[model samples]
Target: MSEPTPDAPSGPPFAVPITVRGYETDTQGHLNQSVYLQYAEHARWSLLKAAGIGQQDLVGHGVGPVALETTIRYLKELRAGDETVMSCRFRWGTGKTFRIEQTLTTADGTVAAEVAAVGGLLDLTERRLIKDPGGFLRELAADPGLLDR
Candidate 1:
């Protein structure tokens, strides 16, 4: 797995750098479309890790994140050996659900794609969306400010 690298200190959105791999490319020599989602997912997890929250932490809390909807806007194409940066930003409103915005940009500052998703914390046992997801995240996050919109 790739390590998380912060592009800025004390920010609303957290970013991680990713280097495209040969195996991740499509037959057309471009990054696979599905891999974009994986990149965004990695960024989200890395953000949680940076906030001192881990998968176990969420599981211990009886909650896990679930994506309700996702939309991707593709711009430039990425190929193997390309170095890109993926960013994750959480937008918390007053509810059990939240919105996450992410962007993938090549090393030359070209925007490869943009991803927007609606997600929520799920109660593992109850198998439903948990109430006060943001509050729960804030309670678990070492730096609650990082979750602020």
Candidate 2:
């Protein structure tokens, strides 16, 4: 599928909104289970971009990032016309990977879902993890904190 039509308030806080179309809903009318993952991913990417970190930032700097692992928890239902606000937080980041927390909340601030991801940066040319690129590692080290900090 293309993607949900991201509503202005339906996207994550740091994320750019995307439209969630009717096609994303199944017979039950709630968003499809698989589509929920897409929503979370979109919010994560938007968060990274807002953080001044993005695909180009990694590529031009010769670094790549990937999801080493992910954990998700679905808390509530999101029907059509429901406005959601995704919240992407930098949980932790380091030399080789980034750990982020993504929450899809309603406009009222009630949470709909929670997603946690651990992403690793890679030097694609060398097919190995990128531990340090410019001052990227240092910046990540100085990031606030997270679930485990």
Candidate 3:
């Protein structure tokens, strides 16, 4: 597969480096497809943490992020010992739903996979989706550097 150009849009602003472990790979010596989704999930949580959102905050607001849908494209294969940088960004959608775009790139900048997920804040007590009552999306939109960590 062709690697994305340096000038290409780099998905999200925040990145977390990860090293592929033998347990994460399949008998084919490549990363398991399910693991890519796990990586994306990890990156999203990291992004939220960097933006000052955490489990405690969610619990305090009686809301938590829930993924409504997810789609992933595998571009290249990752073997054990490969180092990758996973990045994530947020995009608002209708109502309480928002989109998260994540990319996993190899040390040499080859994109191994891309994941897009539809998520929203779920009212833990009400068991339903809720609008941005805490201004999380607003804060994210206003500050591009919020997820720079």
Compare candidates 2 and 3 on lDDT and give the better one: 3
Q: Which stretches of candidate 3 lie over 4 Å from their true place?
A: 1-12, 137-149
Provide backbone clash counts, one per model.
Answer: 0, 11, 0
lDDT of 3 at 100: 71
Candidate models: Cα lDDT each: 0.86, 0.62, 0.75
Report the error of model 2 at residue 143, Å: 12
Better of 1 and 3 by TM-score: 1
lDDT of 3 by residue, 1-149 (tens): 12222234334468899999999999899999999988998988877776667778778868778988999999998999999999887665335676677889999999989898888888899999887432553454334345322
Q: Which candidate is the best by lDDT?
A: 1
- Lowest summed lDDT window (length 10), candidate 1: 1-10
Query: Which lDDT tens digits does candidate 2 get at residues 14-125?
Result: 5444445788888999877887778877776665555556677668767676778888888988777777766665443335555667778777777788888877767778
What TM-score does candidate 1 get on C-alpha atoms? 0.90
**Maximum-TM-score candidate:** 1
- Candidate 3 residue-pair clash tally: 0
Worst 10 residues of 3 by lDDT: 1-10
Rank order (by TM-score, best first): 1, 3, 2
- What does the lDDT read for residue 9 in candidate 3? 39
